[model samples]
Target chain A: MKNFDVYVKKQLLEKYPSMVFFLVVMLFPHFGAKAFGLFFIMLFSLASDVRQKRLDLMTFLPLNRRQIFWMEYLFLCLLLSTTFFVGLPFAERSIYAWLVLVRSFIFFSSYFGVIISAVSIGFDPYGAAFLFLLVDLVLGGIGSSQLGPTFNPYKLISPVYQANLLASLVFALILIYMAYRLFTQRGGER
Target chain B: MIRVEHLRKQLGNKQVLSDVSFTVEPGTIFALIGPNGAGKTTTIRCLTGALQADGGQIELFGENYKNFSQIYLKERMAVVPEERHVFRNFTAKDYVQIWSRLYSKWDDTIFSNFVARYSFDLSQKVESYSIGMKTILFVGLCVASQADLLILDEPTQHLDPTVRLEIMDMLKECASSGRTILISSHEIFEIEEYATHFGIIKEGRVIYSDSIDNAKENHRIVDKGENLQASDVIGLVGSSVLVKTKSDVGRYPRLNEIVVGYLTGHHERSLSLR
Candidate 1:
């Protein structure tokens, strides 16, 4: 518990960058489209801490591997959820807006969760994260076409279709479980 | 205080440690001596719980290491890792505060005095400090932790001669106070001066291990003419042959000579096999 407190404190020391993006996305409402991009970048940075040998510093401390893994994953979740709520009031108050927000959260969270797992499993963090981001962009572009409503991942998880939302939720949970399993099983370094 | 048995580890495609086994009695300074790529760092990493052993047993404080909680190991031991990494964003003052919170026995007064004595700027970020300063800061933090055991990997590397002596002296003092110290280092000459016991590792296996005095007493450098058994000869050093004979037949080897003899013997044996 003491180690967790210090670990969180260490993370807060670098909160400036994340805070800056949060404020920009919240105050300057027009930057909403680019907000996801900035948020992903923040997520990439946080996930890459392990790759940067920052985890090596903690390994010397009192924290165990499980605590390190969960603390990090939960911290990212907190950041992502905070960003989502801060931009909520600016929503268009339509089903489409709600679907876009929820689906984007599910998709990106699962995507970055896999990235963190990949890094833990020995993939170079920079290459894996960027490649995943590129894949997300390609999917988003494809989903934004004439068949946008049907194919668009950001529009697919709608409340109208409980099955669709439920499937997405289940898929996200599975991905997260897989990630945690891989991370905790792998050795600290390659 | 620390015991390792048949410690094995594999990193990527290489089997970094094969059978590293040693013990450090409480209050002794045990130096792990080996050449580069000889598994010293891997052994240290495994001991610090940074790298789990693929197959082996490690016991600390008379309990199986696997059975001890992570916090328990950290609470009783302080480590100065070979990487000497720190949270670069933090200042010295921040480190003191954070480490104080993390380690139950952390002594702020000790670290504060160390900072003042070294004239280090407590407000300056660690990233701004030179390599030597960073090493000093890490060593200072380990000392201030006041743990019962200290595991340091090359604590004197990258340091000036004066600072190296000072740090060794500090470690000597720590050992004298009943804290066990385990260090992996290439500074054989310096380690010879202070280490109470040592283990020589080569190619992932501990080839020789014993107390300093016993090592000297057991090995001798003799002329090449005597009918020495192949098993008794340790290594060839120029015209002289190092032998492991208990009889008082030749000049006793110094600590460095014994190390060189064992390593050179291993090199020759490998070359002949090749």
Candidate 2:
């Protein structure tokens, strides 16, 4: 009945074990591990959908391509928000901790956006992940310098001043919007 | 109730559906027939909005499927897709309950009747079901939802002849009760039995569509010996002439003969729509 609700529930069940594993792993201060876990979950979800040819089953449903993309985006946002809440107290309410949270939110949103866009645009989950990894590595290499802090996608925790952090936040938001545009074009490829 | 015009779709390097066009009148059973890889399934996909068309229009219930919201379209239809597999996460009963709540016209009594007919246990997990049982459960759910339009792809594909016959009766009842049925089936004999209209598709195009009577009336089966030198020979299979120029034809042709005439021998020619 509630198609979106059912879809979210189904995805949650499919990835429950991995999610729990990531949640526990994030309890430690290692943001890189948690980020990798989150990315893995994203890739796994897309891979399963692609492998099973989910569209063949979904075509009979009333969902259009944009709706399908929105469902995926909703799922990603929910999972990310829930995990972030669970980790909120660990920072001990310091401004330093708030900065980490802000930066992580921006960084994760951008990564999620790109990954979903890649999968929606006909890349297999594996291919998308590897391509994203390659691009991030190249960008990090270019940005590495004392003059400008490197834009290392793998880094989750580090000191960031307000001005640059805000700029990064704006850039990440733009990427999220662009991913929406690309993901909306998905469907009918099946 | 259905009108399709110049629907086109390209997948990967191949154009899967091209310039396909047809219509299904209200309460009419339109059987979309074709050989494997002849685009019957693709046509069904485009019609159901599972796959979008690159070009063309699809109108149903006086609204274009391409431009209308999916919720508006779904409110009037129930579909049984080609995939017969049921999700292992839910029991058949769970799905029935979910759909019953989803559709405004769902009939619980009808749902119960179909479950009884199929002898399905709602308590059983879907993974425990055989392929045929899964299909029966899905079909039952679709039928009991009480939508006005039913779009089914290969609905009777995996069933035994007895069950297939039962389904034929069920669909006939649905049609006679005023539902518009669009079905794509390879069971030529089954289509011949119940379909009031027919459309034969090949390589992404609808080659022919007409009433069953009209299709039969327009084509003839000639003995190959008599039509060997005839320039109008449509096709020859073994010792039989599957099709030839219209005349006082030598013999009555079955629907299968007419279909084979298009698929086997007409591969190199442009679409010849009747």
Instruction: Find the candidate with the highest TM-score and give its number.
Output: 2
Instruction: Give the least accurate 10-residue stretch of model 1 chain B, judged by summed lDDT.
Output: B265-274
Instruction: Give the DockQ of candidate 1.
Output: 0.53
**Full-model lDDT, candidate 1:** 0.74
Instruction: Give the C-alpha miss distance for residue B40 in model 2, angstroms.
Output: 1.3
Model 2 residue pairs with clashes: none
Cα lDDT of model 1 by residue, B149-245, tens digit: 9888899898999888888998999999999999999888888888999998988988788999999988888877765644388887778888988
Candidate 1: misplaced stretches above 4 Å? A14-19, A26-46, A84-105, A133-163, B67-69, B226-231, B267-274
Compute each candidate's TM-score over C-alphas: 0.85, 0.86
CAPRI category for model 1: medium
- Chain A TM-score, structure 2: 0.73
lDDT of 2 by residue, B1-274 (tens): 9999988888887998887899999988889998788788788877777666789999888887863256768767888877775544677876776677667789999988988777888888877888888778878888888888988889898899999888888888999999989899888877888888989888888877888878777677777456433435567655676665456657767777777776667633643443
Tens-digit lDDT string for candidate 2 (A1-190): 2777766765665557656776666544335645665666766664457445665555466565566666776776677666666777775666765555565566566666667666666766577667766766554445433444655442321112223566567766776787777655554166
Which residue pairs of candidate 1 clash?
none
The global Cα lDDT (0 to 1) of model 2 is 0.71
Count the clashes in each prediction.
0, 0
Interface RMSD over true interface Cα atoms for each candidate: 1.8, 2.5
